[model samples]
Target: MGYLLITGGTGLLGRYLLRDLMDRQQKLAVLVRPSRRQSPHARVESLMQSWEKICDRSLPRPIVLTGDICTPDLGLSPTEIKWVVENCDSMLHNAASLSFVSTGRDAEPWRSNVDGTKNVLEFCDQARIRNFHHVSTAYVAGCRTGLCKEDELDVGQEFANPYEESKVEAEKLVRSCSFFDTTTFFRPGIIVGDSESGLTFTYHNFYAMLQIAWTLKQSLTAHLEPDGRTNVSYFRLLADGTERKNLVPVDWVSEAMATIIADESLHGKTYHLTPRTPVTTKLMCDVIQEVLNLYGIQFDPVPADVSTMSDDEKLFYHHMQVYESYWKDDPEYDLTNITAALPNLPCPHVDSAMLANMARVAIAGRFNWRDPRVAADVNLGVPEEVNQPNVVKNPS
Candidate 1:
């Protein structure tokens, strides 16, 4: 069997994909960038060890190709290029920069999502690799409030952040490429922890709300009177607690992607890996209040100006401004393609119990706080700046 080459194999989705594919005894190779203190090979080995502990079994190691996605030819050496050309039959492009805010015109999300994709395409063209799988995000629908279909790429809609804009550009590039005989695009929604154990390596998106709620709870609790009552009536949010959020478990996403990848007949199609029953903002707030022991929390529409708001409200909104869009309503995703492909594989419903479990795990993990073992297990090849603190900062 020819080796299946993968990029971002050390990332959250990539690690799960590696586990699923390796379990099938498929030959594999991963393109990884060297870190500040560890080589590419060392990074892959560390990830594999973590996977072994998670799965409770030994897994076959993948061939590690030291390279950078931002550079031409992925910065691969002459011998490494030859190895890929001779042994690799297909490629899975899963690496991406997850920065929501853009630092500059040509920085971060743009460099990795747009430029990195171009480089990967160029390399694939030279290597004569036809079959390709690209992982994208469903948020590429942007600020559109209606139903988003799998067949749609650009709808002339406004993007909430640079990350969404970059992914849209990248997907456009892949769709336009003519050299690839088979191109499959997998667009996943807000990916959270595993459904069963609520275990994840990183925290953002929905988890950001949890982080904020936890911080707010601690802050308010500090001033509680002897009867456990404070002057603060209710914590305000920018949403009315009825907006829907499409949150799919990371395991489900990986499984669905892997299943689609293994079937050659399913190529040349776009799949929106989203949940059928979305979790509501009210449910989220309820769970957060329960988990963090924060009562009297209320969600409401964001005011035009916060100049006249109370000190606590201003402080809370100031810190949560970066994630304001996430709290708003999300578009309805069309999952026709995925539904037909995996008719029997239903997306798990994210209920109150499930949210509680995820919250428990996240709190226990301290929102993936820096630990030597966690670092070794969850490096996504991005810089330290991209891994910003998950907490919402309080204004002085």
Candidate 2:
């Protein structure tokens, strides 16, 4: 059967991408690493079961094969490579490692994010895949902090961490891989949870800050210092005034990407999938406060200053910095091509309240926050950024 070959088929966006194709009557054959040992369907089945509580279960299933992008020709045997060449009509390269901190000296990011692209390209050449779709983070534009065009790359700006650097390089790989008849890249800014439920598959996401706050609320997390203003705080810098964060829900991301790839003319175009009305850090923090209050957690707001955190806490705080700027300070994206392609499809637009509702679902047990370890799966994970409001505990 002709297939839509997808890399990272079981990832956050890959699941949505596969489902979109299936919805259009497209067969999916995703590439999996041989190390998985088990059949690809079984692996995805296990993973989906684990994430079912977190990720939306509306996606369709697909065929899977053990393949690794890190290896030559994606580590596929000559026969397997030829199979794709003749059977797969299009490919979506969505697998990438987003480790911002491990850039300079760490080699894994480059090997997987950059060289992985090279290997995939070689395989595509061998397979002569008809079309290629790549899912790249909008951060690839780097620290330009201004309007970024869909066609632009190598914007003159410094990157915050290795993850950004690696994405930049990986994108370069996709751009140069012009062997396919058509190539398209979709760059999304700081993806959060589902727009409807604020659902997310990965724990490492926009709510990372809230998780930090909840952790610190369990004890002193860190001291936040003043940096600038954001709307949620009413433009009032937090007690420890610092830059506010930017966040976008995941539903918009997956749905928008699904919409973008449907157009054949959009094959070589780049589309920036971002919110029409942006949310600020202060508003994001406010929603965190409400979620905590919803679950009866308490704490006091303190400006977070990494310099003041204990050695162990400092390590955690450092990770927080990776996603901090990306969400709050978004990169400019051109969406004209996408709007032109799908006129009725709603763009991935979101704001603080929409984000808050999603957070509520995540904390309120609409999907299962109970990890089997936490005494109360019912607890709303929030830190004391605002005055601790008195409340009751989870019933169960």
Candidate 3:
């Protein structure tokens, strides 16, 4: 049987992909870093314990291998490397530094996104690999303010963060690889919770604002941001005081990605794995506020004027640098490629209420940032860190 290999096989998106692949009984192999003390297989097993929160019943087990992308050939043992070289048929490049505000220039994105990608491509080349699937973010559109579509490039806008530039470079690298037989690039927009259960693995996307909202519910922070009118799209602006967060469930992303790989018709193209119906930032903020209020916490609505204040008052403004670019991107996808491939596969649901519910659970469950140890006053994500006016980072 043909074997499949995944780089970020343990990430939120990787969990879904692994589940789908295993359900089909596809022989799968995943690259994992050997822990200082534990074995590689043990590390993957520990990871699976965490994945139970997101994966469906169709999930299957994975064959984990000890490897590191930073080192040569994923730090694989000589024999293991040779074995993978001979048996592997398809490769999924999903591992990446999703955090936009990284420790340093190279540490932030260039290494995993660019350098790591080159290494993966090289490994395949040396192994005589055939199929390759690269997962990317839709933020590559940068500051382009309009309907972004799949397979379209060069909008002439710009990127808001270093993460965007890195993703674009990575995609370019995948497209340029000479020996790879089949390549598919999946570009997802502001990925978030599980559509059905409203569950999320990490606290990202609009979590910054929700952090404040969840805090307000507990009478923790006295913040006053816009109540309506948040400019979220090129067409209908989500007025200030309006909070819009476009999020897709991990289940949906993995399912779509798996289906794409299973089908052969789609190769040498890009696919936008975005939510069919995104929630307005306003509704996202409102639900959290109301939920807190229901819990007997007093949360007074801060006027839009005070809400949109600069970093001095709006401490979370720093992190908005990565998210601010999302103000636009009311995309329209053909779906001809996705729907055609997964004829019977069900689409994951990620509407406003669904996302809000998921947000509620994730926040109440783990994102209690108010705890001093959980980073109560860091505010490392303000828009000012973006290094540009309005935009998040400087373009190279």
Best by TM-score: 1
lDDT of 1 by residue, 1-396 (tens): 688889988777888899988777778889999888877877788778887877788887888888999998898766677667767889999999998888885899899999999999989988878899999999999899888999998979999899999999999999889999999999999998899988887788878888876777677435565756443344677788889999999999999988888888888899999999999888988888777765666667855378766777777778778887787688999989999999988888888999899998999988873312435444333223333444222111
Query: 2 or 3: which has the higher lDDT?
Result: 3
Candidate 2, residues 1-396, lDDT tens digits: the string is 367788987666666566566677677778876333444545565554445444545555565655788888776554455556556888889888766556344476777898898888777776778688888877776777667787888957787667777888888887777677888888777777667756666656556666655554445422333532211211112222233333456666666666666656557788777656566555666677666542222222444665665564465446555554444355556667667766676555676678777776665653333222222122111112322343212111
Tell me the deviation in Å of residue 111 in model 3. 1.1
lDDT for residue 373 in candidate 1, whole number 0-100: 40
- Count backbone clashes in candidate 3: 30
Better of 1 and 2 by lDDT: 1
TM-scores for all candidates: the values are: 0.89, 0.76, 0.76
Candidate 2 residue 55 C-alpha distance from true site, Å? 11
Off by over 4 Å in 2: 34-39, 47-60, 103-106, 220-246, 294-328, 364-396
Give the TM-score ranking, best first. 1, 3, 2
For each candidate in turn, give its C-alpha RMSD to the true structure in angstroms: 8.7, 13.7, 11.7
Weakest lDDT window of 10 consecutive positions for candidate 2: 374-383
Candidate 1's C-alpha runs over 4 A off are 219-234, 369-396
